[model samples]
Target: MLWTIIGIIFVLWLLGFLFDIAGNLVHVLLVIALIVFIFQMMAGRRKG
Candidate 1:
């Protein structure tokens, strides 16, 4: 689920960059998604 969200955010960021619309917002979202993904991974590792 987290990976899916990250993938969607990445795709959106790519599209935004190509179309030059809300590039900054998309970039910020991508960064946020990356952070969330990293946190999720860390938590999963600790759980195991």
Candidate 2:
């Protein structure tokens, strides 16, 4: 779920970087995704 969204955002960020589109909004997405990822990691959930 969250991982999927992160992967998609990453791909979009790469494409935007390669094609030079969206100017800066795509970078904002990258920053947002990084923050979410860090938060999720710090939350510390167990699957056992």
**Candidate 1 lDDT by residue in tens digits, 1-48:** 887999899999999999998859999999999899889899999999
Using all chains and alpha carbons, the TM-scores for the candidates as numbered come to 0.91, 0.84
The C-alpha lDDT values of all candidates are 0.91, 0.88
Judged by whole-model lDDT over C-alpha atoms, candidate 1 comes out at: 0.91
Query: Considering only N, C-alpha and C atoms within 3 Å, which residue pairs clash in candidate 2?
Result: none
Give the candidate number with the greatest lDDT: 1
Off by over 4 Å in 1: none
Which prediction has the highest TM-score against the true structure? 1
Instruction: Report how far off residue 20 is in candidate 1 (Å).
Output: 0.5
Clashes of 2: 0
Tens-digit lDDT track for model 2 on 1-48? Answer: 889989998898999999998989989998999999988887766432
